[model samples]
Target chain A: MNRNAPGYVLGFMALLCAVFGAGVATVHYATRDMLAANERLNHNRVVCSAFGLPVEGRAPADYARAMEQALVVATVPDGRGGARSVYRRADADPPVVGFTFWGMGFWDRIEGFAVMTADLETLVRLRFLDHKETPGLGARIEEAAFLDQFEGLRPDWTAAPDRRVMIGPAAPTQAGNRVDAVTGATQTSSALMRFLNEELERLRALDWTSLEFEPLPGSEP
Target chain B: MSVRARDIFKAGLIGDNPVYRQVLGICSALAVTNLLANTLFMCFGVVFTATLTNVTVSLLRRHIPKRVRMIAQVLIIASYVMMVDTLIRALNPDIHRFIGPYVGLIITNCIIMGRAEAFAAQNPPWPSLLDGLACGLGYSLVLIAIALVREPMGFGTLLGIPLPARELWWHSWTIMLMPPGAFFMLAILTWIARSRTGAKETSA
Candidate 1:
């Protein structure tokens, strides 16, 4: 059996693929539960953060307990054939809704979560999960200075699609929906503004009351 | 260690460094060096992949046909990198979130492939493993040095911890956090390292 022969080469390649494929599969399968738990913890943390719940310095178990006790989950049509999970605060007098939003950024896709008031007219809070923006320039979106602008700001849902929530040079008073964009990050600012406004519009159009929501595990049904 | 192993380590660390000397794997060197945490994880991923890939390639060198060795090497490298990614994602999701975008870059890093092709394909398994590790460490050394400067200057913090008396004297240098900052640091480091090495050779 010549090592260079076609049969030997093919056999070696097949063996290599089988061994490596199986190795990767086994590791992935073994870690599947841990990965899922990590993801759930992150989700709970994000939801907790979005609604201004205490997350910093809290344990993972605390986040889980908070999610189980304070939030309800609903699966809704995403307008793209897939269903997306949305979270609602169980006890907020007027209710608060949170959902993940993502869109193209300066260099890559930026993903974050947005929480809105029950009417979907005011932003409760915004927090990023992942972004590939330039570190000092565009990546500043994650900074409290930038993200805090969205909190308590009302989006003019009646305004045109593109003008619902502006992200640019806000007036000195900082009273309108317009928020100051990060300096020296025009491209990232524009891209964020577009996606965020689009997400706001989508949120406004959704019928929240009609969608069925199941009480989270450990919560009173 | 044997003299031969020492020589391999010396070559990987100083004589034929994958970053400053050989000028390989600059993409990740520049990309992840701005943040110390990111650079550390990137180094771990590269070291894990390079060392394992080298051992695997050397063990199979006799059986692997020359015509298709590249593909086999790649499959091995990719498998190891995937495992590293999975482990990091599972064990430390916070760091994973910060370095996640750059983890996939390990597959294309030239240092791992360069070692597998240049040394591992012909060497014994143990020597090849040493070479891979030395090269990975060489790359790590340069990246960690750059991150040490870049993070402090750019963010006025070390590993996100605010520097003591930061507000009194610290000022953020935005450029230090960008790619151009890496270019400057890499060039300066390479020049200093080469000058010292050149002087050593002349004196010897």
Candidate 2:
């Protein structure tokens, strides 16, 4: 066999591809169920956390149980001709809705969740799920000092309402929606504020009053 | 075990440490060392990928055509990396998110490919496996050392334990949490290790 021949190279490459392709496919299939279950558990945990539900030191199974008992999944149109899924507290006297949102940060994608009041304007809590912002600078968006400002703050929706959540240098003094940006992370802060407000506008347009409870995909009914 | 096998393993850990001596895999060392937890998980991922890739490459070395061997080695390495990524994502989604991109970037980590070409392509399967494990450990040792200094200094905490910054009057060095700190730390570490070993620095 001529090892240097084009035929040999092509055949070897094909063989290598077949072997590795099979290996990766096998591993993916074997782990698929577990990965899906793990992702569901994490999503439930984050939604629970956003609603100020107890999740610390609790196992993922426990979080899943808590989510099942306390929240109902609702799918609403995102005003983009697409469906948006949100979790609402089943037991709240006034329904609290939680949804995940994503936006481009200074470095890469930043994913977060905002739990809002039934009126769909007031933020109950905000938390980041994942991000690639620079540590100690842009990454400060995850710090409680930054996120705490979003809690209980309502997005101004009156006539000529403030759609932009101004990220100021100092502590927010505006009665309308404003937050103090992280020092030195103005781009990330601005990006976050922009994305959150955009998502809030989208949520405001969602027909919350017409939402129907549906079992979450992959959850036991 | 033969003396050759013992020497091969020892070479990676200290005698010719990948990070300190060869300065390979520095990109991840700098990126993940700010947090102890991130560094530890990244090291484990590297170790798992390296050892498995080494064994797989060595086993197929005789059959792999010389002209296409590099591609074959890469294919094996990438497969194992995906498996590791999936496993980490399943077990700890949060940490998985933190290190997901880096884990994929392991395909470009140099150390794995370096060992495959230099060691696994020539050596037997068992020896190659040991060499790969040693390389991973060597890399991990250097990274963990950096993390030890960086995490506590930057965050005023060790593994998330608060270190009484207010009472102890210890101010966190903000630089320690950034990329430049990794550069300084790696430079100092390489200098100290080389000077102690009486090895002169080689210019690239």
Residue B34 C-alpha lDDT in model 1: 84
Cα deviation at A18, candidate 2, in Å, is 2.3
Candidate number with greatest TM-score: 1
Estimated TM-score per prediction? 0.83, 0.81
- Evaluate fnat for each of the predicted models and list the values in order: 0.78, 0.66
lDDT tens string, model 1, A162-187?
A: 87888886554465688888999999
Q: Model 1 over residues B1-204: C-alpha lDDT tens digits?
A: 899999999988888888988899998888888889889998999888999999999999999989999999989998998999999999989888767666777888889998999999999999999999999999998999999999999999898899999999999999998899999999999999888778344554
- RMSD to the hidden true structure, all candidates: 4.2, 4.3
> Which parts of model 1 are misplaced by more than 4 Å?
A79-84, A90-94, A102-111, A130-149, A152-205, A211-215, B160-169, B199-204
* Model 2 fnat value: 0.66
- Candidate 2 C-alpha lDDT tens digits along B99-138: 7778888998999999999999998999999999999999
Model 1 chain A: ten consecutive residues of lowest lDDT? A169-178
